[model samples]
Target chain A: MRWIRETGPVVGAITLALGVGAIVTALTGYSVPQVFRHLAVGAFGDWYRLAQTLTQATPIIFTSLSFLIAFRAGLFNIGAEGQLYMGAFFAAWAGFSFQLPPVLHPIVCLLFGAAAGAVWGFIPGWLRAKRGANEFVTTMMLSYVAINFTSWLVAPGGPFHGTAWANQTVRIATSAQFPRLLRGAQLSWGLIVGVLVAFLVWYLLFRTPRGYELRAVGQNPLAAEYGGINVTRNMILALTLAGALAGMGGAAETLGTHRRFIELFSPGYGWDGIAGGLIARAHPLGAILAAVMMGALRAGGQAVDRAGVAPADLAAVIQGLVILFVVAPELIRYFRRLVRRKKLGDIEL
Target chain B: MEILSFNLFISALRLATPIALVALGETYSERAGVINVGVEGMALAGALTTAVVAYFTGWPWLALIAAIGVGALLGALHAVWSVYLRADHVVSGAAINLLVLGFALFLTRVIWGWRGTSPSAPTMNAWILVGVGLFLIGLSQVYIFRTPWGLRLRVVGEHPRAADTAGINVYRTRLAYTVLNGALCGLAGAFLFNNLGRFTDGMVGGRGFIGIAAMVVGNYRPLPALAAAYLFGFVDALQMRLQDYIPSQFSLMLPYFLTVIVLAGFLGKAQVPKALGKPYVKEQG
Candidate 1:
């Protein structure tokens, strides 16, 4: 019953968002039913499509987990995007620079990437914890800085620029790459790692003493402090962990999917993580399903575009609408009040 | 010496116009106890409106009006979500940003056969808008500080229950200021269109967020906010010149990095409104 109660709003929001997508598609002179059909077909049309969807879901799983952990500790780590970029670049650097055995190489690259992301996360965490800075602004500003900084590093004349005309590093060594899960499919062991990490997060969040303290801080920081938990330390820990999660995701993308750090490759996976975390009500286990749902939308969106049914951008509209509806369940209550013709006042949930 | 010439000052003012306008708008909304992080989306929507309208109608003035209307509409929607529905303000604002980006891109592709750009359209002089922005900032300093209405706005934000007891309409005041904030963002977008003579998806870039940074740096005051925008604008101008000596990527980073440093410097010192981000409820007798 509690699970249903918590999940009811998210389910309702998804349905309504799809309805809005239909309307927008019709208004844009596309066949609404065809768009929906294509969306379904594109997402689960065949084994190949399913593999592609899972491939797309892999990175978001990491990012949403990053957001989930931070949100549980009352922090918003919007810098996940930047952290991901840093991780990707560093992972790529490690991939090409070393001559290690196959099993050892990927591990070293992942650690280097995670460390870079952790450092980035630590800066804002320290600032918020020690200097009383708002993590919201600092995280956002740092995202832009990291993006530009990484872009410069890979552009022509930079230290890591590849010989290729494209703005990307040289292909990472094969030994550093994650083994493909299926022949003739882009799916890699990265997805398996992401799932394992999700299980780890669920255990950490629900079955650990540290998790209790973190949630207590999120619920009421002053109360947590009075209860002897170090609120500041927890805040720093949450963001640093969040950064590590996102960084590992970036490293995975480079090693498992792209095989190199491509410039401006992310199509807002970090932002998608926010929506995914919210859709899951911040449950670590639920994030996997939410990520897969988002992946379906992206994959289906691309299919629709290819079929000329509708632009892929419609997925974004649906996503934004989902966030709006989820955050404002009061909208439903307001309509209910209007139906009853009652004067506006707070209604008990 | 060439980099520090009179042209730099002129260019700085031009670059500062949008940021100043956005800061001024944010000052009004934040002063009235609303945190509208959707300002970035509002400006983008405004820019899109100007391009779409101007492309079809060939009337710059009409396009400008449409842009402002679209911005205000988005603002009003945000107000409905954040203010009336008691949603998380940042979450609602993020939604607006995403929705507008999707809408803008969809419209561009549908109408122009391009993903995010439109052909050059007839545009009015952006400097005129800059001049008007300066005047309004000057007037706002007085309007926000000296007027009874301004005091009412402040009172509503600081202590809404008291303001309610005093017969002020707290909800209405919040709604009105948020709408005004949206309109100002629209004007900023229009200025961008006029300056560039067209529109691209990335035209607004990070200026909207930078504008919020300016507002914080200004301590939520109009005149000081404009000054903060100008300072950012000057750095922006200087960075363009420095691009020759350094990598453009590093040069591009200066403004964002500076914003982080400046915000870190100002965080706890800024006088935040007491009722900011809280949903006010009327008690029954």
Candidate 2:
């Protein structure tokens, strides 16, 4: 029943994307059906394709969950992108610089990544909660700084520049790398871990008193403080946890794929997760579905490119439309209200 | 030494123009009570439109006008989402950025047959636009703080109920400012690319957000924001000139790092307008 209600808006967004894509296809003299057919086959044509989708979806799940938590706490933690970079960098530093024993190496690296991310998250949280700084601007600035910082660190003669000159760190040891789940595909065990983390987030949000405080603060900080909730502390905690989650995403990506930290590693997975959380209405479990859908679209874009119909950027357009279309219901309702006000002959709308 | 200093100062002003214009626009919106997070996306859209139109038409001036028009439309789209739909301001803004990015790329491919970069067009000596933007910034100080209309807008932003009770149209004021905000952002972006002679992906490079940072540092005031933009422009220009002295990436990171520092240190000192993000609904008497 819940899904039935949600499907209307979700379907509306999908329909709008498909409708627009079809119009463009028809105008450009391409087969609309063929484009879609390739889209499906590209996303799920074989086990390898499915694995690739899962591989892409893993980071999104973590980042979406991160956004979901902070958003639920009424704080916009736009610093997830920066936090993810820190996480990946710390994880890589641990993997390459340390000579830990085989069993403990990956675990320590992941932990270091989470800690780095949490510290990054905490600063903006502290500023926003205590100093009245806007997270929107701070996070945006921090992201550029972090990206460039990483670039500098990986540059020649800098701290962690690899021999390849590609602005990357050296590959991690075998024990520190995430084990693959499939024979030939790059799918890692991180996919399962990401799903487990999703479950943990669901439990934390719905079944914990700390979660109650965060939600209360988000809903009404004044009322929550009146009710004895530490609003400032809760806001900070919310951001810290969110940063930790996003950092783990970066960790998972490095441990799972690439096996090393690279500058500009993410193609906006952190930002895309914002769209994922919105599409899922901040539901923890629902984010997995949203992430996978986005991953499929990305895969479909590759297929479209291979088919010579459109560029891979069409995927970005679909993601963009998903966000724009998600708001379509509200737009329609607003217009309807305007019409009703006009019918009543009211001077103001 | 004098010639070098003059060249650097001129380059700084040129670099600062877009930031100042966008910050001024954002000041108008925030005073009327909206943060207008779509500034970056709006700027990106304007850049693309300006580049494409100039490329094909041989008229860089028309491109400038068309860019502002497109930016205003995008801003209006955001206004509709924010004002009428009563959506979360940040959410709407983020979505607008996402939409514009995809839409801009799509348009880029359609117009230029390439998604990476557009061909160079005729450069409009943008120093004139810079002068005009600065003049407008000076004029807006009076327009916002000294005029009766500006007073009403301020009241609506600070206390919409009070403004509404006093017979002011809070929604219209905010909607108008938000659109104007978009126009300035459009001008900022158009100016950035017009002088550069082409559009490339990621060319806006977070300048839109830096404009927001400038507004915060300036306490939502025009003169302060212009000054802040100049400071930032100076840092950016110095970094460009110091490419051999420091790692290029480190030099490039200075503006973002400094903005963060300014924001962190001035967190409490700088004040935002009250009722900035709240949606106003008329209560039944």
> What's the TM-score of chain B for every model shown?
0.98, 0.96
Over 4 Å off, model 2: A24-31, A100-103, A327-329, A332-349, B1-4
DockQ of each: 0.72, 0.66
| Top model number, DockQ | 1
Sort candidate 1 into its docking category: medium
Model 1 chain B lowest lDDT segment of ten: B90-99
**What's the TM-score, to 2 decimals, of chain B in model 2?**
0.96
Q: For residues B1-285, what per-residue lDDT tens digits would candidate 1 score against the true structure? A: 678999999999999999999999989998888988889889999998999899899999999999999989988998888888888787777678877887877778888878888889999888899999999999999988899999999998899999999999999999999999999999999999999998898888778889998998898899999999999999998999999999999998898888888887777888988998788888887
- The single-chain TM-score for chain B of candidate 1 is 0.98
**Cα deviation in Å at residue B230, candidate 2?**
1.3
lDDT of 2 by residue, A19-94 (tens): 8767776675667788788888888899998888888888889888888899999988666787888888888888
